[model samples]
Target: MSSLKSICIIDDDKIYTYGVSKIIKNYLPGNDVMSFENGKKALSAIKEMEQNNDELPDLILLDIDMPEMNGWDFLNEFQSIRDKVNKEIQIFVISSRIDQKNQEIYRVEWDQKVDDFIQKPVQVEALKDLLA
Candidate 1:
């Protein structure tokens, strides 16, 4: 695939963020990769960028479970901001907690907004495919 302007990852796990960011940089070095510890921090940064009229990331990798604002909350709040941004941002929900209960919740609550669902411990080939 052609290079994206930027990609954002919102997750509480520092190790996962670092590793995934590294992989993206290695494979798509031209793109900017950003990470946030949780949804709240990510939303703050996103709002700041929006206020500044800055270019937002083309893609967002979101984690389902986190402290200080989880993925579901982020998605709900993001919808309003998204309309004002005038940019098409693809949101991919990446989580390790896709049990039956959560799957039903996601299907019922957010099936339309999310571009895709990626399970945690994402495989290298799958990541490549995503980038491609």
Candidate 2:
């Protein structure tokens, strides 16, 4: 697969963010990787980009649990404004909340916005495939 230009990582773990960013940078040189401590900040940046007519991230690595705004709420908010954006953004849920897979909420909100789900301590091989 071809490489993506911009990738966003939304998670609270600084170590996880740094490690993942390193892997992505090494694996896909020249790719733009940005990180947000929480979904609220990520969403705000994305919305601002929209208003400024700037290019949004091509892919987003999302976490289910976060402060200020959880991944679910972020997804909802993003989906609400999707129509206003012209680009296709692929969102992959990368969270440690494996139990969420069995919840009814996944079946509902995930049907449209989320492209796929990945467990935390994100597997390099799987991530490589996504980044590929």
Candidate 3:
């Protein structure tokens, strides 16, 4: 697989972040990976990168729930700057929530904004799928 120029992981769980980062590193060595504990920080970082005319990440793994700003909030902010960044950038929802209703909402309402929905405790095969 071709190496991604960059990727972002937005989640409140440190363990999840570490695990995903490790998997990404193992599969796509040398690719830059930026992570944020919440959506607010991630949004701020993206804005800064935009201001500097830096290329946005090729993909984004976002969590649905968070303390400061959730994934939904980030999507709102992301829409505001969508034109400033790469419109083709892929965003994958990674959440531990098992709420069927919320899943339906995400599938129906936010389908256009997100690429795929991945469960928590990401597996190596799933990571490989992402690479593929």
Ranking of candidates on TM-score, top first: 1, 3, 2
RMSD list, candidates in order: 1.6, 1.9, 1.6
Q: After superposition, which runs of candidate 1 have C-alpha atoms over 4 Å from their true positions?
A: 99-105
Error of 3 at 30 (Å): 2.3
Off by over 4 Å in 3: 99-101
Model 2 global lDDT (CA atoms, 0 to 1) = 0.85
lDDT score at residue 89, model 1, on the 0-100 scale: 91
lDDT of 1: 0.87
**In model 3, how large is the Cα lDDT of residue 86?**
54
Candidate 2 lDDT over residue span 27-67, tens digit each: 77788999999999999999998889888998999988999
Model 1, residue 3: C-alpha shift (Å): 2.4
